[model samples]
Target: MPLRLPPLPALRFFEAAGRHQSFKLAAAELNVTPSAISHGIVGLEQALGVELFVREPRGISLTASGADYLSYVSEAFSLIAIGTQRLPNHRADRPIALSCAPTFASRWLLPRLAGFRARWPNVNVSVDTSHRQVGFPVDGFDFAIRLSRAPVAGTAWTRLFGERFVPVCSPAYLETLRDGHGNADLRRATLIHVNAASEDWQAWLDATGIEGFDTTGGLRVDTIQLAFEAAGMGLGVALGRRPLVDPDLDRGALVEADPATIASTTAYWLVSAENGDRRPELADFKRWLVSEAEHLETHADASGQTVRAAVS
Candidate 1:
């Protein structure tokens, strides 16, 4: 059933008058004559069968009934404005839809996303994880994080960071390894494969000239972080990607089982479609990402180790 209510236009004038306590002030705000404001309020009060305002020689003020009604009317108008805000013409801000790999999102990006929010609180960011590369101009993604050596054609590729390969193991597991040849002793250690198409463990092993290790036997996980955690728990030696393992290594959660490391061609790239940076928020995000990447690279360069990421 329709709500039993006074006329909306009259109610608007009444609320404005009630708030200002002066028909002249309400008329000035509403761009109407003072008489119109007074007439609208009078009609509203009549429709509600209540004297909503008390007029005086000096001015006018809302009665107790009007004050009570003003609260509900003002809230209703606020709700109406809120409901209208979702309309395309009314909304000034839209969420920056970002697509990225699950591992990269969780391990690297999510941890650092707080800084972005703190800086650009008004700009909304929505992240979705997908192993598959998003189709630009069709998928509707504003930005994407692609971990690959080659950039997707026709897209702007902003290099986030380069990746390297290392075999990471828990301190407890490293303690069990033979001292003379850590790489060769890894033959006895269990391998935690990330199950990525790149086969990081094998790539690292081949780079170090280590052979005859039983690569076939080990627990396999779908993502790098899961394998990292498994390795940290002393389950097995998992292949660690750059930056992702840096945190664990620094915290002593995991250690590089082999001193040798290989700088892979693969790296994390920020991919955007043509004209994707048209939005100011997107441009800021791109700049922020580049800044973060530069800082990471600089720190890694200072330490003589390089920045690195997602296995694509």
Candidate 2:
């Protein structure tokens, strides 16, 4: 007997709309018009004799029936992905294309990637150190690591870690700034700033309630990695974001100039296609990445006097 079901295209439209909770976003992802998505979903609802969404002024949300149906539809798609992956012509050796910021690619990911390789020797990752946002599948990227305050729209997001920006400098440089109280006196010290993250210094200072520290003038560099390099050379104090700076701190190449830290409003997140982790390789990578992040958080400095700052 032939399968009795809704039209495949209508199912596809319904799945995308349900996943995103917005007809507009669904249209964007599917490369169609919002009207087309709405019409398709409406047709599907009519065929099933059910209302799939609770349309509101601000947005649309899945109804109870819609939510239940979505699970089955999502599972069907996952099976399709897995089946396609297992096909004879499928290239198992193909690299998993990834996009991320250059600084993160160098200072953080590169250092830890060797372990990922060891665990999944056949699974290769091609890292694209591009700062620009990329469209998934269309851009040929399987995953992306991004720093943002919230999850990127139209993709599945797994938060890697929250960020804490701390003041760091060479031990020798720090020694030169100590006052009679044996505390690092930043008011007399040169402030190093990353041109892209000029607000870090001010955020740290505000969070610490430190007065008389001038952020108006200092060594300005293009990247956080460069700023750290300058600080390591005993140039001046730089605000180093956590996890990225964790390795340096462990190596004693840099020390916290002050005990206070600003918990940034932003964090690092791993993004992929919706339901992308259904692939066994992607699932493994996601698990490994989360575990690595958890390990870092477990061993991170607990002694720092933390102050929340909405650092961009």
Q: Each candidate: what lDDT?
A: 0.78, 0.82
Residues 122-156 of candidate 2 have per-residue lDDT tens digits of 89889998555565444456789988888967689
Candidate 2 residue runs with Cα over 4 Å from true position: 1-88, 301-312
Q: For residues 1-312, what per-residue lDDT tens digits would candidate 1 score against the true structure?
A: 977877888987887777778888778767899999888877877778899989999988778887898888876775564445435654357688899887788778888899999999888888998454454533456789887878877778988887777888999998887666643478788988877646477677666677888887889888887898899888988877777788899889999887667777677899986666766678899999899999988877787753233223
Residue-level error in angstroms, candidate 1, position 103: 1.9
TM-score per model over all chains = 0.66, 0.68
True lDDT of residue 167, candidate 2: 86
How much does candidate 2 score in TM-score? 0.68
Global CA lDDT computed for model 1: 0.78
RMSD of each: 18.9, 8.2
Clashes of each: 1, 0
Worst 10 residues of 1 by lDDT: 303-312
